[model samples]
Target: MTAPTLFSPLKFGAFELPHRVVMAPMTRSRTAQPGNVPTALMANYYAQRASAGLIISEATQISPQGQGYSFTPGIHSAEQVAGWQGVTRAVHAAGGRIVLQLWHVGRMSHPVFQQGHAPVAPSAIAPNAKVWIVGEDGLGGMVECPVPRALTLPEIQAIVDDYRRAAERAAAAGFDGVEIHAANGYLIDSFLRSGSNRRTDIYGGSIEKRLRFFYEVVDAVIGVVGPDRVGVRVSPHITQRGMDCPDMVATTLLAARRLSEKGVAYLHFAEADWEDAPLVPEAFRRDVRHAFGGAIGVAGGYTLDRAQAVIQGGWADWVAFGRPFIANPDLPERLRQQVPLATPDTSTLFGGDARGYTDYPRTA
Candidate 1:
């Protein structure tokens, strides 16, 4: 039998995807200031790229406390929900499927964004990472992350409730589903890793305890949105940002098994795409396939050939592209026609106007 190609149609959760090219979630930090609301410009940006099988919207904070970076949109308020409604309506009008990526950036934050309070984490540990903070001069710069306060049990429960409310707001905003941002050294990631979570309470210690917060958030989200509408993004191998945990792979496998039992729609693996980053192990992929029977998606520095190869190898059901989608809104079509892609301006990637966000040209 001929193997499935990247252009093959497949059923993903509640949507019938026309292809397997997914737009990976990206944080552009271009939301409306003073409220972090999604603007019409941002709606236009997503609407232009609605041809993909699926577009995972940028990482959005669940509440004021979840805001780790400057100008990232939030889903906790009425205005924010209304703002997202416009974006979702635009995407759906263009015949596309999009989901919100719920995020909380644990210790990967600065006090400037936290109302003078320290960021919260599984333990009182500081990530050796920096976050982008925009100064009063309208310039954005990377600021070092400081030691965070350990989240108490009640506070942890509140965050899980926050995830639930976020999911509720996502559905109200007309999203097709939601992707839990449990990766990239974020809140959930810290709770899942031993290197960052040194607590001896029920929220830490062994792998089971370490996963308590993650599972709670997942269950809370699923309660609001059914399992079929839930997908999780995990980065077991991307060990940067003080996330170098030796037991991460094993922990991810366990997560896969448990998620399989929960019947979540998909599991997305966020791989390190840098030139010198280590390659994801083939054995780990095979192991994940065995553990999680749901659809799998992977994102990294994937070219057309690489994406097709992985799908044909039965490692992933879909392949997500990040930077490619930024500059080439019609990315799947460009890959289909074998056209050259336009490179995105790195300078305008974070906080910018239409010059780079919505002004990228498509082939004539």
Candidate 2:
């Protein structure tokens, strides 16, 4: 097979992607203190990888209350906005198109990271798993997740407004667009899954009701940046953070259909768990594509060959690479030229300095 099928030009939303390869969002936890603002080093990191067709930034909090871990960037403050402006300017100067991923961790937060406050969620249920958090010893560490308080109706509405505000900030900071983080057992995913949501209110119970918060969020974000500049991510069956749906197939199809009718830019689906997990079945991928007529990006455990096959088979318009891109800054060039990729240093993945963040050299 010929190399560079992944490098073919493609149009996604309002931007023309230089190639079908995307730098998928991965949390780096490298922001500054007090406000968790983006740093100058971060700007340099993104600028170095500007060759990517599209750069989806690491998950950024929409509000102070939305934070689940310490040192992750936020978009709700002037300092944070100004800090990100530097990043966006650097990326654009290097000829890269970038989008900010708006995120809220919901119940996946420890009280220590919450600034002496309890984390909020669709219900007062605690996750059955642990969450990564900063340790008092100053080194990066992990801790057990605290039980979160269920948000009142008014609180939920306020969160929607926060997302709207975050989108405005992203646009002002010069991002090409904004991607709502509705996947991976986050705030929106909490509501979508029956296991995490045990509320007896308008935002819970039936699938339609569970989807209400996400739809409202989309409407709010679109209001701020318009529908053409918005995108949403969904993880149907990754099963992370204690999230599971009784009917994964039906729920995913319904969510895709609803999002398609909304006229957003694109829908990103994490078809399956990436770590030693089965690939998404062919029938399910086709079903999702049929339900969602607009552009689709499939991620999670995709190699160069599998990515090309997915696009050629008409299953997805784009394929996002996470770990591969981490170790290879010139991932697209390497794939196109069939060059060997560098091994990623897993020890430096999270809460690291410039070492793992930007020290990855390109293929010579």
Candidate 3:
């Protein structure tokens, strides 16, 4: 039999991934009310996509203050842990490996979403963009992001503790591992980007300083989950929600090299915004691959052929699919069979029930 390309087995950290395809972390805002707990519907949704080598759950808030959107699952409280237990149970029952994505929105949150509290960040700077918030109508809505208060040194340390606690809770909840979401304009990403972090303290200024916050958080998470079971996500060129690195090459290279030194499980890098951005330059990909000795997973607007080429070329160890996995629940099966994918319904992408969440048809 011919060897499988996308279906080939691979080793990522402690787990032996059955395939090289991972379900990327995506926020759907469908958790249950009052504490943003994961629902039974979410369990069904993840279980349905078990064929992938691994599943990274939606970016989950580490604490109440970490939340920037309504109805998203959290891993802080006992109730939240119990809710995710159901999700992890379902995924494991279907013979799939799953990881909980730990997140903090920082200035990407509105006071309304923070329950009348100000948003927090490494520095007090307003993102030149907007964030999705819950409107007065009790539905998902958009609001201009407000200037966040620069966190005090003590508060910054506290947030690191929050990540440690969340990681411990994730393991107790039965997740195979945890992915630190240091990407996509969140708190850690904000600190890493010079445009967002304007602090004068040791946590800002030069590249080494800018990465201090991330290093602390990673240390805390690894202390809880161990380095072998923790992965991190980063997006160097993605200027989402008003985040842009002045020098993409320098910033990403520094971040990648630092992460590699930490000895985390894997590094998931989204080279560009998916909509209509340019492909990551081959040279840049190769540079990152060389910098980070650990496993690498690349996402954003990748097709089967392109993904296979990236893996075969040694640029990345695995490929993650976001929209493709959402629209095609059995994406791995479809790719193996060489079938066309179903179009994603952008209308039902966020703030919906199970219609767009779990109702995507599986291949027969």
TM per candidate = 0.99, 0.96, 0.96
The top-ranked prediction according to TM-score is 1
The positional error of residue 139 in candidate 1, measured at the CA in angstroms, is 0.7
> Residue by residue across 110-211, what tens digits does model 2's lDDT show?
777677988999999988767677776878667778889999999999999999899999999999999999988889999989999998899999988988
Candidate that scores best on lDDT: 1
Pairs with backbone N, CA or C atoms under 3 Å apart (clashes), candidate 1: none
Ordering by lDDT: 1, 3, 2
Tens-digit lDDT track of model 1 for 120-220? 99899899999899898999898899999999999999999999999999999999999999999999999999999999999999999999999999999
Estimate the Cα RMSD of every predicted model relative to the unseen true structure. Answer: 0.8, 1.9, 1.8
Give the poorly placed runs of model 3, Cα more than 4 Å off. 1-4, 274-276
Model 3, range 250-303, lDDT digits (tens) per residue?
A: 877887787778788899987674567867788988898888878999888789
Candidate 2 residues lying further than 4 Å off, grouped into runs, are 1-4, 273-275
| Native-structure RMSD, model 3 | 1.8
Measured by C-alpha RMSD in angstroms, how accurate is candidate 2? 1.9
Candidate 1 global lDDT: 0.93
